[model samples]
Target: MRPQALLPWCLSLALAVPLVGLTPASARAATDYQAEDAVISQGTVATNHTGYTGTGFVDYTNVKGSYVEFSVSASAAGTSALTLRFANGTSTDRPMDLSVNGTVVASAVSFPATADWNTWATRTVDVPLTAGTNKIRATATTADGGPNLDRVSVAAAADTQAPTRPGQPSCSDIGEDGLTLAWGAATDNVGVTAYDLYEHGNKIAEAPGNATGKALTGLAPNTTYDLTVIARDAAGNTSPASLVVDCTTKPSSDTTPPTRPGTLAVSGVTANSADLSWGASTDDRAVTAYDIRSGTTVYQTVTSGTSATLTGLACDSPYTLNVVARDAAGNTSDQSNSVAFTTKACTTDGGVPSSIATLSTGWTIPWGTYWMPDGKTALVTERDDFRVWKVTKDGTRTQVGTVPNAVTTNGEGGLLGVAVDPKWDTNHHVYFMHTAAEGNRVVRMTYDGTTLSDYTVLLKGIKKNRYHNGGRLAFGPDGCLYVSTGEAQTPDLAQDKNSLNGKILRMTTDGKPAPGNPFGNYVYSYGHRNPQGLAFDRNGRLWEAEFGNSSKDELNLIKPGADYGWPTCEGSCNVAGMTNPKATWNVSEASPSGIAIVRNVVYMASLRGERLWRIPINGDNESVGTPTAYYVGTYGRLRTVTKVPGADQLWLSTTNCDNNGGAADGSDKLFRVTID
Candidate 1:
């Protein structure tokens, strides 16, 4: 006979133990409720059982369908191992079924006798359990009923808490047919399983929980959408919805090119540069920029304008040039009629100048100087005085007039930048960027040879601070005005596209944003800390110089719609999504203010470093060579450097009267330096 089979009834009585609610130390971690402690029907706690844990086991009546139900608690909803301890005195095997909650997990499970009622055995099965409390029962299946039943043990399989809500979603790469969405990851008690994307209250896409971004396709052009995300766990528990985001698709792709440029012509040919103009091109999507080419090579790319200056050519050399127009969608037009011209013979020695000549002296903070159409007289703006003066080539200074409504508070804010209109002979209009009672503004005034009048406000709403009141203005080769601004001591303003502060703005003479600006705004390039220098290279590429905050200064190449990281990055850093500077300088060495490009070389005037920097331009004007400093600590606080029209000379101004330089009265001066 099997050892589990019954021996005799007398042996069962001898092995009976007294009933007691005692739990074993071995089952301390798992919940072990005594079988007798459970809800029983047609069963009773009997001392006839030996070798059973937790009080006396439950003995069912000798009839089918008798059961003992126990309440089990699970910390999480997952698979749990259930162990049943029992013994049978009869020789026959008793069959039972296990039910968890309301569902039966195992039917007709065999419980064989273990060498009489004194012997015990365990039957284990894994069953699914819900979180919180649950019911598990063992019911007899045969007429002999089930064997003696002991405690029910339940342990949690894993944690069941849902993941934390995901962060706000952002959209990028918004093409006409697709978009890329990204968000921060969510945290969970166990682990996140997946992320579900919802659009307009309906599920649209999914990503791995570890992924923070998703790319979607098949989107309609010029459409807007409301999107969100949710995180889930392995247990199917979902987190709260993430913040909603509104995204709009770009307009349809513009495959049509602009009409071929016409009437190309060259004039004002210098020894190393030539001025070229062409008739305007027509386009369905508006022209953005034009490329002036020599044969198949691009010589210069200027903003949507008719004229550009090609510099750095051999003296008296003949060259063929053509013009091609391009739209914002990267469509290029056919080349215009070619024009051939020879450069003028060199008038100066073909080498950079090593000496500077003092043209004028005794000025108090000369901020800007622009050469007049006659090329002999220049207009200068005094920062603190709010005065416009006409300085002759021989150091004759005459006050033209003070701009009306101009105000100066902090030492930095006052009359700043000045620009002469390209059609100055006919319009006689000159523009100025200055501080006023309201804010910083750009205004145009009439210059009638002797005096200034007819002031008109062109642009306004540029915030100003004691420092970082960037006020630099220049007319690009495209005939549009380019203005540089500062962040006004507000770090976040540099990254804000809608703010006028901390940006390089491209606008028409009347102050409207130039057509085809990256974002329908006056902002051309943003994310500047305190940019004060704006210059276009021989190839019409824009370059900027910015004063750094105690760390490093920067010289950057400006690109439309590109972000130059401020507050996040101070110098060259391997940061994603931010444009890096072309060159960097220690703050003490170069607080570069104004920059000018001549013959493929960039000249930057320094304030704190008290020097000038010459950086040679490389291929396509995309990069710069090593920077060489000149006159370090000799000239005090050089402020502005402007190219002398039709000459190899540049006019450099001094700012020794301002707070930083701390020079005596009449110490500031303007010097002319001839550079090759």
Candidate 2:
């Protein structure tokens, strides 16, 4: 029996499923929920859900690069919420995020996973739900970046009570002699944490002894004010603010300045404000007020605890701020130090793109491209979410297919490279380098905008490790598939031409070689280091674009029987028969992944450089031009480049999603560039 088969009856998930929910035709996106009422939650009750509905599998095997869409029915369709209660069945303590439909629902930090394979943790993502079978997928994400889903209960729409209305702040009351402020207790299904009290607008005291509560205190007489309370449960959910209470403060001059904060530092800086954050500032009586200074001028003031946001500042400039504390009894402390930062530099370097525009939507992870059969659209491949998108001259893209039973995700599996058949108009076929269960394989598939099928395996036996299968497929001038496979990390395998690793594969359109004398239809040339790009110039000479082993990246001209050194001679060397690079860049400058020869110019995408190096392709073996850098760092890391149909522009793909912390607003992208 499989490991999951030995599990107890209560937590078992069955692989074979009977999905009785909405059909694909009835699928639609959910909108935001209006008029939120009080939310209530209860403690988790252990119920034996052995045979639930819709895609439940107790024997959950590895579904790498694929989404496990639970097709369970909702209680009343719109009365649906999502909860991921799962057991970590593996030793690897990898983390992943959860998503609903196509929208990003949460990050790993928001839903932290555990490596304690024996225990189970449940997380909930309460979003607006639609009627019918809501396809809830447990998406897998990791820092090293691969998809690995363990056991999870995706379809458990159990009948439970509403969690308390959460995320509200506490309140405080002030009276003439002394005030009495009371707030509702922080409530949750698990338990409440604490309550905080606020007076007038300031927190005067705390209740419940924890991070929760509302407080009451003395004040000036005859001043009318409103009071509110909030609650926080143990699971970190806070309740809604309660109804307001009217109060009056007694007259008394509590004119003491709040104690001065000790050391202060400028935390977050943007165009508008410097988020002034510091450690907890103390007070003798109570921290009543704060003063902010710019250089030596009394700039502004605030009454808060430790930190406050200093807003209304200049962009792309330097500024400094100082903060002072005061107590309620009119005692003032010295000003805090270390609040300074340089503002956002929009134009640090002289060379950045002045304008950018969107190209297409629904095309994900687009990494490389080949011109379609009609010469009107280019068939593009992506990094993750591997699907083929057809990019046309008008800047529109349509997702053709995910792959031939291929998953678009995991660390490196996806639709990678697309090669249109030379007789594509008649044959109606295209070859793709994609990830599969058997490993990396070259597949021939039929394509329309929404449908994909008729998969014929062109070449099968490639070793698909988790990383670097070197999947780039292209048709040579001789009308043959000149495929490039990486040695991955097995360097010794690269030196052996007998194996597919580290060699350029030469085969007929259907995985056979052109009638040649080079080893009878197998190895074209040997010695390669992740040869990700293959293209021919107008001169009909084949050039390879490859990143070196942690050193210099090089572009080499392929000779029929030459060795373009891999683990041996990197960058360039003084050796015989081993081809030297015509141009070289340090590893920092070029993780040069993909290149395209357009109008006698080779445009190469730099994943590390975050720029496109336009090298003039003089001929098959020759390339000149001073190499211009375009769109450096505006978009993060660029991966692939494909020439626009009969034009000077090329489409570039950004690679920030492959486990890099890109900006929240901007991560991986597809850029269109026009070379001068």
Clashes of each: 4, 51
Write candidate 2's Cα lDDT for 617-655 as tens digits.
544335463454555445667778777666566777766
Task: Give each model's whole-structure lDDT.
Answer: 0.80, 0.57
> Candidate 1, residue 34: CA error in Å?
50
lDDT of 1 by residue, 276-345 (tens): 8889999986998898877655555788568887754545556888989987666789999999887676
Which stretches of candidate 1 lie above 4 Å from their native place? 1-350
How far does residue 134 in candidate 1 sit from its true spot (Å)? 39
C-alpha TM-scores of all predictions:
0.49, 0.47
Q: After superposition, how far is residue 292 of candidate 1 from its true place, in Å?
A: 46
User: Model 1 — TM-score against the truth?
Assistant: 0.49
Worst 10 residues of 1 by lDDT: 19-28
